[model samples]
Every structure is written in structure tokens, then in C-alpha cells.
Target: MTFQNIFFNSQAAVVVFFVLSGFVLSPSFFNKSINVRELAGFYVRRFFRIVPLLAVVTALSFFYVKSAFSTWKVPFANSWFDGVLAHDVPLSASILVKCFVGMNSALVPQNWTIACELLVALILPFLVKACTGRLWLAVLTFIIATALSFIAADGGGKSLPVVYAVDFVVGILTFRILQSHDKRYSDVFFYAAVIGLVGARNMLEVLTGQVDLPFNDPLLSLVEAIFAAVIIYGLATKNHMSRLLSVRWLVWLGDISFGIYLVHFLVIVIVARLMTSFLLPYSLPTQTFLMLIPVLAVSLAAAYFAFRFIEIPFNDLGKSLQRRVRTALSRG
Candidate 1:
């Protein structure tokens, strides 16, 4: 894929993720103190929202490639299994143990982010409680975490945890801005975010050796900060931009976006492999584009179905569990 297409399709989607996350989590952030019962309920809901659908996708992947299973090897070998069990079914049981402990080696690669998101949710209550609506401190923590991630990057996986953390914190910050009803700052941030994204693309190109640059690291950092700030601002404001984001369709996409993101990669990879197997004569980019069409259609359809059947039911179960626990604790 061309750099521009990749940037807009993937990187920009990540920015949208940050903004949507902020919008979703703003309420909890503004509460200042996390109600433990509520926090538990929220996490339970989130878990059900994600895991079942992921499990289904993982299973599908395994079945699709079951014949190839025996050929798989160590380290990156399970990448072939396609099914959730085989995905987690490591070359050995010791690997399986590690997977259970959140060192997940899954059939679906995108699941790494889900694991990170779950980790964030587990600690969110404490984070919200500690920050106590302090936006600056939350932002600072994100900056430090991101910086550490850059320093420790092992082909970008090391940075992902920090990036997700920043995304969650951006959500919290959005919550704070909304609670405070800070319009002016939101307006400024909105425009600044747009500018930052444009600049970041140029800087990323330089870092990737697609372009020349001086002082790339510091410039990239500034761009990221601006992008993050804009996301927070967009979610926080009541301006026209915010209203656009709140549009029903966009909001719906935002709601299921997590599922879409998780499932899309697998869909694409599977379809691409199938195309290659069938000896499709199309160029790589053309085939990639064609593959994406069905991938998007199928992934979205599956995600919606998953949201209705799997995510909703499990979420309700979590809430039910939380209520029962709360009642028992209250009596104690």
C-alpha cells in the first residue's frame, strides 16, 4: 500500500479511536471517584463486549486453515492456525500457560490490542480515582508512557501498550472537558489536531526512510501530542465538529469500531491468502483493494451480529454479576 493510503486508512483510524474512546469514557472520568461497583460492572460489560466475538473469529480462522496446522512451527508458527484454540494452542503447553496469563499468542494478531484494552479497563478505576479529574496529570502520564514506549520499541509492539494507554487517557481527558464544558479550549484543540495530523504524516515518512528529515524524533513527538490533544478536544467540545462526530452513523460505527478493527485484519489476511491460492492475476494493490471490499462487508456484518448476540448478552451477564456481588457485599 502507498504511504498515503496506509496513513489515512490505518493511522487516521487510530486517531478516530482515540476520539471515540474519549467520548465513550468521558462520563466515568468526570465522576472523579470511580464507584467500585460501577467500575466492576463496566469492566464486566467490556469483557463480554469483546471476548465472545473474538473467540468466534479465532475459531473461524482455525477451521479455515485446519489442514495447514501440522505445518506450523515455533515463535511465529501459530500465526497459521486461524482458530482461537489453535491460535492459543502453542507449540507447547508452557506457551499456552503464558497466553492465559495475558501473554497472548493468538491466531488473530489484532487481538494484542484487545488484551491491552482489557488491561487498561482493569486499572481504569484506579487511574480515574487517582487522577481525580486532573487533566494535566493524566496527559503527563500519557506522554511519559508514550516516550518510554518509543525508547523500548521492538518493531512497534512495545509502543502499542503505551499508545493504547494514551488513547484511554485521551478518553478520560475528553470526559473532563465535557464535564467542565470548556468550549474555547475545545475549538483551539480541534484545529490544532488537524494540523498535527498533516505534519505527523510528513514526519512519519521521514522516520520510515521514505523522506529526508532533520531532528525526526522530536518533530514526531510534537505531532503525536497535537494529534492526541485534538482527539480529546473533539470529544470534549459541543462544536460543529463534535456534532459531526456525534452523528448517528458515525456513533454507531464508533460503537462497533472495536469489533470491526479486530475482525478486519483476519478477514483481509484470509481473503488475501485465498486470492493468492486461487492464482488471482491482479496486482498486489488491486487485489488488496478488492479483498478489502468483501472483508469490510463481512467483518462489519459479523460485528453487528456479534454486537447483538454475543456482546450484548455477555455485557448483561456482567452487569447481573456485578449487581449480585454488590448486593451480597452490601449485606455483609
Candidate 2:
């Protein structure tokens, strides 16, 4: 595999996540003052949306090290917190507390993103409230955050909260723009985002020897978030740029994306163990290719089950609660 192929990019996708979040939650911010019960219910549903799978994954982590990964000898390159694929995972009390609090990357590792999502979500309503009618406020906030994105922070599993929140802000801005502007301006942002992802990369490569900044810096993360925001705008506006995103298969994949994101690591570990037990003689590439099939299949299946049984019920409950609360308020 090529270096870029082997390289896992958590940054580029993060921007997409934040911008999508802003677009998704944008509608909720439309009401000038969200009712207390509805707001509470919204938070509750959001909690269920992410935390249930995260809890399951965190529980599995303890078992993961001892069972599936015990025989896989390779360790994480940088830190012990990354957790050795073997049974050497750090499972301290504080880390466990952090897991519930949405701050535990040491235990679940990829869950740092979960923490960021939660943080952004919790604060999003406030941003929306403060800036709904005040366009200048939103612009000022985005501008300030954009400047801060350059100041380097950990580009690893646990990124800085503020830096990550920049993407969240971008998403919020995209939503605000789309919501307010009926003109074709949403198309402009969408094209800007597409250019940021595709054209900018090529342009930079032409100028510089090799594309260096995309991999190394959170600065690039800020730029990528613009792409995410615009794409979200396009999709929301029903612009031509986002036509491909509405395809049934792709939309299905997006539905279970969170669960897939949370569970894929464990799935990879299990497949690695199976490969080790039965196919020790196979080369790395052969084993890797074999791992992909089971990993994708298993992750998709697990995500569907999680969505059906755990996510949907709780989400429905939240919606029901909000309706009841609103009805009672209206009657009074």
C-alpha cells in the first residue's frame, strides 16, 4: 500500500463530522428560546445517540486487551495510553470516570472524538441562541476561532477542545448561512469546501514538492472544516454538488457511521487475533486483506443492531417526551 493509503487520517473526517453536526442541529436553534423540557430532552437523546455505544465499547476494552489482542505482539508506537494490542491496557479508576464524563481517550482511545462531539453538542445551543439573529456575532466568533486554529495543539488521539470546537463553529456557521440565505450563496460555500478538499490539495502540491501540511497540523484541520461546512450547506440546500450524497447506499452508511467508528477498532483487533490463530504463515498484506472483509461485515452488522435496539428507542423516547412537554405547555 502507498504511504498515504496506509496512513489513517482522523483530521479530515473530523471537519466533516463537525460541519455535519452544525447542519443537523441547525434546525433546533431556530426557536428563539427553546423550552426547558425540550432542551433537556434534546440533550438526553443526544446522550443516548453516542454514549450507549461508547459504554459498550469501553466495557469491551477491558476484555479486548486480554482476549483478542493478547497474542498480537506489536505495540502502539508513541504512548502506553494508546494501549498495547496485548493485555497491557490502562484501566484506572480516574480513566473510567473520564469515560462516563466524555473525556477518556486513555481507555477507549478513539473516544476522544466522542468527547469533542459531546462538548460541541452541549455548547451548540448556546452558540445558536447568541447568534441566531446576530450575524455579526457568529462571524466574529468564527473569525477569532479561525485565528486560534493555527496555534499548534496535539494532533493525536486527544486533540485540544477549543481547536476541535472550531469545526463545530464552522458547522454552526454553515447552518446559519443556509437557514438565513435563500439566495444561491449556499452554493458558493459548497464549492469552496469542495475546492478546499480537492483543488487546494492539488494546487499546493504543484507549488510545494509534496503535500506536507495536511497530515501534520491542526491548522489544516481548520481549513478542512470549511470544506465540511460547505458540503453540509450544499446538502442542506439541495444543490447539485451534494446529489451523490443522497444515494441510498451512501446514506445508509452515514446512518450507522458513529457506531462503525466506535466499534471498528475492536473489530480489527478480533480479526487480527483470528488471523494470528489460524493463518500465522500468511504475509502482512494477505492477513490485512483478509481482516478487511470480516471487519467491515461485522462492524456494519453490529452498528445496525445497536441503532435498532439501543439508539432508536431512546431517540423515540426523547421525541415523545418533548411532544408531551410542549403539549402540556400549550394547554396551560
Candidate 3:
């Protein structure tokens, strides 16, 4: 309803990624004809795509964590900012293993999503098999997943992969719908979906009169994923907004978006420290505002480099290995 509301749902944006992941990765499994070798190749590509950058980022975060324990200091009075760097986590093998597996680390807190993604990726092929067997089964799968998510939350296991499994199911169902029916929605409908996506949580709050619902609530996440599905539908069907999104620069940014996600936290911490020393004369608000420019610049530059040197190379290696798998299977 308002301009600020359009940006209020950052958690919904993560849900959008989940839905998009389901959509993008669905085509391979939905044919209902994939063999083990093909599935193996699929797993290989996904593993290579996600893990290499994550490994590098985790290693970098470990260095930052060491520094934070020894020498890092908050320049300002923000509690959340201070808590992330100055903390009581010990340097232990268990924590390091957890970080590698997508548990939260102060340096790369976003890795949990990657862990969820990896889990979904492994089970997705089976999900495709189960959900596509019948129409009612697909709906039942979603219902059960939602129920389980709530159950998980009640048991204080909100971060478990089951909590987000429904989001991926929404995506898989989106693909099924698109495959079965082809309709071109009007521009108004596409724009409406965008509005629904960005304002999902706010709209839910208005409807329920429950402000500040828990962030990982399954019911709220389902609404966000459904809205995301509509937006993905609009784009996949090539609506007017899809044209805007397909601009060359925007496409290039999408290519490096993963890298940006991995490196931005590191940039933020480094810049915050430098800003404390150099811009100490300014108010905290002004320092934060001034910090954005360099953060954006350095993050973009670092992401681009990582994409060029790290991601692309690894992706190609995955593809090459996939080809070999296919070739070997054919011979056997």
C-alpha cells in the first residue's frame, strides 16, 4: 500500500528464492524419465554449483572470526551489529563443521539458507516422483509439509529443513501448472503478483491483526511462497515486467548474485571498521549512510571477480564432469 511496504519483507525475498529454486530445478526431474546416471549428474552440477563458493566463503569467515575474537571492536552502539562480531563462540571443530554445513556463523550468517537449498536439492527428485504421481498427492504433500512445519516449530526445531520443504513444493507445483496449462496473464495481473509478493507479510499482519509474528512461521512462509510462485509464473511466461528484468546488466547481476550474497557480509564488517576510524566525527546514521556507497561498490567488484574466477570455472567443471558421466553410462 505504501512505498516502504514494498521493501518490508526481506524474509519473503528468501522465500522467493526457494520458490525460484524449485521452478528452475524442476525441469530435469519432471520428465518422469530420468535414470540414476542422469540423477547423479544433476547432483554433481548442484553440488559443484553451491559448495565451492561456500567453502571459500566459510574459510574467509573463519579468518574474520579469529580476528573478531582477538581484535575486532564495534565502532558504534548498534546491538545487533555488535553482537555479530563480539561474541562467545569458541574456535572448535564442531562449529567449523557446522558452518560448512550451512549453520549460522557470525561472518556468513546467510549460509543456513544454502544448507536448506542443499537439502531440498537432494530430496527434490524423489519429491518430483511422489508429487507428480497424482494430483491429490501433490496437494496432500503440501498439506502434510505445512502441518509438519508447524509441528517442528512447536517442538523448537524451527530451522530444520522440513520447515521450508513446503516452499519448494509450492515451486514444484508451479512448474506442473505451467506445464499443464498455458495462459498469458495481463500486465495488471503481473504487477499485482509483484505487489502481493513484496507486501505479503504486511498484508498478513493486517488480515490477522497480529503484528510481529515469529519469522519462521510456516503459515506465513506458505503465503510468501505462493505469491512468489505467481511472480515466477509471470516472468516464465514472459510478461511485460520480464522484459525489464531481462536487460543485459540485470542479467549479468543475476549471474553474480550468489557471489554478492557470499561476500557482502565480509565487505560490510570491513567497511564498518574503516568507517569507525575515518568517519568517527559523523553521527552513526550519517556514517551508515556514507558506508553504503563503498559497500555496494566493493561488494559488486568482489562478486564480479568471484563469479569470473571461481563460480564460472567450477560450473564448467561440473558440466564437463557431467558429460563424462553420461559418456561412461552410455558405454556401460
The top-ranked prediction according to lDDT is: 3
lDDT of 1: 0.58
Q: What lDDT is obtained when candidate 2 is compared to the true structure?
A: 0.67
2 versus 3: better TM-score goes to: 3
Which 10 residues in a row give candidate 2 its minimum summed lDDT?
Answer: 75-84
Q: What TM-score fits each model? A: 0.73, 0.81, 0.91
Name the lDDT value of residue 190 in candidate 3. Answer: 76
The C-alpha stretches of model 3 lying farther than 4 A from their native spots are 1-8, 68-70, 85-88, 104-107, 155-159, 326-332
Q: lDDT of model 2 at residue 175?
A: 70
Q: Which runs of model 1 end up more than 4 angstroms from their true locations?
A: 5-12, 15-23, 32-39, 68-91, 94-102, 133-164, 184-192, 204-222, 245-248, 273-279
Please give, for residues 1-332, the per-residue lDDT of candidate 3 as tens digits.
Answer: 34544665668878888888888888878866668788888888998898888888878777766664435565574777665544444757776787776665544778768878988788898777666668888889878878877777654433557888888888888888888886778888778877787877778888998877677777788888988888888888888889999999999999999999888877787788766677788987688789999999999998999999999999999999988887788788
Worst 10 residues of 1 by lDDT: 69-78
lDDT of 1 by residue, 202-317 (tens): 65875687653322233354356447666556655566677778889888886676578667766655555555544356565676577767788888887787777777787788
- TM-score-based ranking, best first? 3, 2, 1
Backbone clashes under 3 angstroms, per model? 7, 1, 0
Which residue pairs come into collision in candidate 2? 193-227
Cα lDDT listed for each candidate: 0.58, 0.67, 0.80
